[model samples]
Target: MTESLNISIQFGGGAELLFDKIKKREVDLPALKKYLPDCQREKWTIRELLLWIKENLLREREELFLQGDSVRPGILVLINDADWELCGELDYELQNRDTIMFISTLHGG
Candidate 1:
């Protein structure tokens, strides 16, 4: 049987605008070796997941959602309800059924 990583991704605080107003999505990501041949890592990390999301899930205006190799400066990331900063940020390894949320800190008053 093929192994899959199931995760829930969410957007809020105006971040949904970049995802076509879709606030939540369930994704089943193929194993790292199955999808990414150039990658040397076995486990999926937030860094890899961000790239995956940019390639697969992001619908439009990627600039509003990302900057360089990570989320734009004003965005906040959460992993399973805990601040991703405390969870190793981009180095955090993703787990099956993990919940990841991106919230944009920029919004009009």
Candidate 2:
């Protein structure tokens, strides 16, 4: 049987504008092995989550949300209400029911 991860995603600090003005969503992510055939890891990480968001959720201005493979400089990432940096950044493994939030610190002039 294939396993799936159910998690919460939130966008704030105007970041929701990039995601069709939606502030929160519940998502079901397929197993890494099934989602990415080349993936050797058994679990999903923040790195893969970013790619998933870009492909499935992000509406436009991808440059404002992603920088290379990670979030842009002005965006803050939180996993389960804690800073992503404290959770190993891109290497952080995702857990079922985890809450991931993206907040844009950049403001328009």
Candidate 3:
């Protein structure tokens, strides 16, 4: 059997399933898992994670992360060994057996 989405998280290289659940899951579960190791380790479903963050984390559009402030928190970001913005934006479509990477960066002296 083969999965429609096959992505890799460089540091440890974890396996994940990618699917956008508009209504079912309130949060971006797959994204949280892929990018945030802590979220994945907790084994949180997209629905759970999203609701949690919606109720816990996430701020206003003052600081947009993905896409042109339209996607809000667009999943399927591609960034390997680098930060989020550096990688391609949400425009990245679904690539068969695609290996997506999630990287968060911080800049300072």
Candidate with best TM-score: 2
Error of 1 at 11 (Å): 0.4
Preferred candidate (TM-score higher): 2 or 3: 2
Query: Which 10 consecutive positions of candidate 2 have the poorest summed lDDT?
Result: 31-40
lDDT of 3 by residue, 43-109 (tens): 3332332343334443443233233332234243344434345534433333333343422242224
Winning model by lDDT: 2
Preferred candidate (TM-score higher): 1 or 2? 2
Error of 3 at 36 (Å): 22
lDDT of 1 by residue, 1-109 (tens): 1488999999999899888889999999999988888888888999999999999888898988889889998899999999999999999999999999999998767
lDDT at position 8, candidate 3:
36
Which residue ranges in model 1 land beyond 4 Å of their true spot?
none
User: Model 2 off-target regions past 4 Å?
Assistant: none
Ranking by lDDT: 2, 1, 3
- Residue-by-residue lDDT tens digits, candidate 2, 6-76: 99999999999999999999999997888898987889999999999999999999999999999999999
lDDT of 2 at 23: 99
Residue 16 CA error for candidate 2 (Å)? 0.4
